[model samples]
Target: MSGSDSDRESAKNEAIRIIATDTASVLKFYGALEPSPGEEPLPPAEIVTPEWALFRWVQVQLLMSLDVFFRYRGRVPEASALTHCWYEKIEHDFLDAEYLVLGVLEGAFATFERKLQAYWQMLRPDGVLMS
Candidate 1:
């Protein structure tokens, strides 16, 4: 690959790493908001499961796209437009994600956390997820 291509790939990986770490920390913080059950009892290192990880992975993708949009907001109007389009896509997916993850957590009083839900929900009450 060319140097430009390599640079792009590097940037993409870095973005993925940053977003993944951020989202995982967010999940951990949410998990800390409440207790749990099972053979282990309480605190979990990973919050829920791989499902949460995957959701966060996608969520970070959306975030990265938005970041790119804002990064090029001035020099590249087209980038912003494209990023807006991706934002809408992620917003659509966020609904299914909420239903899937939060719905799963709903049954477990030990797992259910209002603060986490509120944190994410407040970002996009209209289901558009602006930021």
Candidate 2:
């Protein structure tokens, strides 16, 4: 393959990796709750520090994004970036599933920045989380 082709393939692989990771990270809510006793619910999934909240957020986003695909019969605009022609140099009607993958991936990553922000404050001031 050409250089550009190689780069495109690399990017596609990376996107697939991230999409699988985020979707698979969706955790089940079977654990018991144990709040810090006084303060309002916090992250780590509104409980304490279980990494569950972030996963739940991603899961919800994935579900909401998929709702469009399953419920709307995939009626997206021709100008949409995530469509049959997205990942190809030449557009055709062969297996346009990459659009759904891209959508779900976008939804799954929506919580990344929020997750960072949720923990950002911990890196400063009161040092509540600082050891």
Best by lDDT: 1
Kindly state the number of residue pairs that clash in model 2: 1
Per-residue lDDT over 1-131 for candidate 1, one digit per residue giving the tens place of the 0 to 100 score: 23575686677556544443455654654455543555454446464543454444445434445445545542445554767676775575455455534433332211144533443453323332222
Candidate 2, residue 24: CA error in Å?
7.2
TM-score of each: 0.27, 0.23
Taking the candidates one at a time, how many backbone clashes does each contain? 0, 1
The local lDDT score (0 to 100) that residue 76 gets in candidate 1 is 43
**Cα RMSDs of all predictions?**
13.8, 17.5
Once fitted onto the true fold, the runs of candidate 1 whose alpha carbons sit more than 4 angstroms away are 1-3, 22-91, 96-131
Q: Give the winner by TM-score.
A: 1
- Which tens-of-lDDT digit does each residue in 1-131 have in candidate 2? 23575675575445434433433333333223445779765344334222344443443344344433433434654565666545352232121223222323343211233322232222122323211
Q: Give the TM-score of candidate 1.
A: 0.27
Candidate 2: 10-residue stretch with minimal lDDT: 122-131
